[model samples]
Target: MITRTQLVGAWSLESYTETDVQSGEVSYPMGRHPEGLILYTFDGYMSAQLGSGRRDRFKGQDPYGASSEEYTAAGRSYIAYSGPFYFDESNGRLEHEMFVSFFPNWQGQRQVRIAAIDDDRLHLGPDRPMPFNGRLKTASLIWKRALPNS
Candidate 1:
């Protein structure tokens, strides 16, 4: 049983893999080498941001001034959300009670993940396949603890 205390800190993304429920086709949601950060605070708040490793730069320097194509590209390649989080140590479950998210539909959602920690790495995944793109797929994400200076 992993305690909340053991999870308070920043973790760097190692991988994000998805498996199609029907076809068993495994794919990378954020490319072969994605980038992300998941942070947990002692205050019980958590946030996560994951993105494709290679994102094209917007034509304009100002973020708000990017072209529609750039905005679409950016939107398609990133996922972010934050909210209060809790751990059910006995069940090995982590819950994210999302207050907000990049996908508006997920706001106010209670996302549950089965989690395990080995060495400095954290593995998280849903118990069953959830919707992605337009189908059901199970996703497993791996994260590694950040170094003190990282």
Candidate 2:
């Protein structure tokens, strides 16, 4: 049986490879980045920092036709959200009740995550529906155990 104690620690994302359902292509957005970290403690404290990549064309362009800038806001590119988190051993699930979010719109929301723990990696997938481009899609995340003192 999986227990919460087994998941208590700081983990860094080793790779984030996803397949675009529409195009059937694989993409690795978070590869070899130290800025990604997920912490789960026994005291019910949880924090997650997801690194951001280059913005897509539409995301970086301004409606007013302003010159696009590269790496100007890249340094601040990261998704950070933290709050109280709970673990349900019966179903092997982790729920994150978000208090603060970098997106500002996700504040005060509970994100249910279905977690799968293995010998060296932990795969977390969203249990709730995620709206993408006005459509609901499933979002999955993976984290590898960070060696102690590494």
Candidate 3:
């Protein structure tokens, strides 16, 4: 059974890949050189940071034509959310019920994440298909457990 203790500490994003359902093309979100860090603590605190990238877009901009300004703004933005997390070992899933989110728009939303854990690596993605704009899509995020002192 997956326990909270097992998920304590920090994790670094290893890769982020997604497929555009409409275009039938695969995209490496953080690109071949993705940068991000996600830290999850047993005490129900979580923080995430994503770096600047060509694919990063603003709220109303076309994701396909995301500009450097948007990317820069997103890179500098620090997102922090605190909530309780539950793990369902039988189904290999993790759910986070957010009480407060740095992105005010996400406050009070419950985000469910399906995960696959192997050794020191954790792979996470949306529990269900995400509707991007108006199309269904999926995102694959890979994370590596950070050493205690690192």
TM-score of each: 0.96, 0.73, 0.69
Best by TM-score: 1
Give me the candidate number with maximum lDDT. 1
How accurate locally, in lDDT, is each candidate? Answer: 0.92, 0.71, 0.69
Q: At residue 70, give the lDDT of candidate 1.
A: 92
Model 3, C-alpha of 73: deviation from truth (Å): 4.5
Candidate 1: list runs displaced more than 4 Å.
none
**Worst ten-residue run, lDDT, model 3?**
48-57
Clashing residue pairs, backbone N/CA/C < 3 A, model 1? none
Residue 85 lDDT (model 2): 93
Which portions of model 2 show Cα errors greater than 4 Å? Answer: 18-26, 29-35, 52-77, 132-135
The global Cα lDDT (0 to 1) of model 2 is: 0.71
Q: Per-residue lDDT of 49-147 in model 2, one digit per residue for the tens?
A: 887544334354655553445333442455689999989898876799888887678889888888888887888868755654344555567789888
lDDT of 3 at 101: 74
lDDT of 1 by residue, 1-150 (tens): 788888899999999999999999999988999999999999999999999999999987898999899999999999999999988777778998789899999999998888888989999888788999888999999999989883
TM-score of 2: 0.73
TM-score of 1: 0.96
Ten contiguous residues minimizing lDDT sum, candidate 1: 88-97
TM accuracy, model 3: 0.69
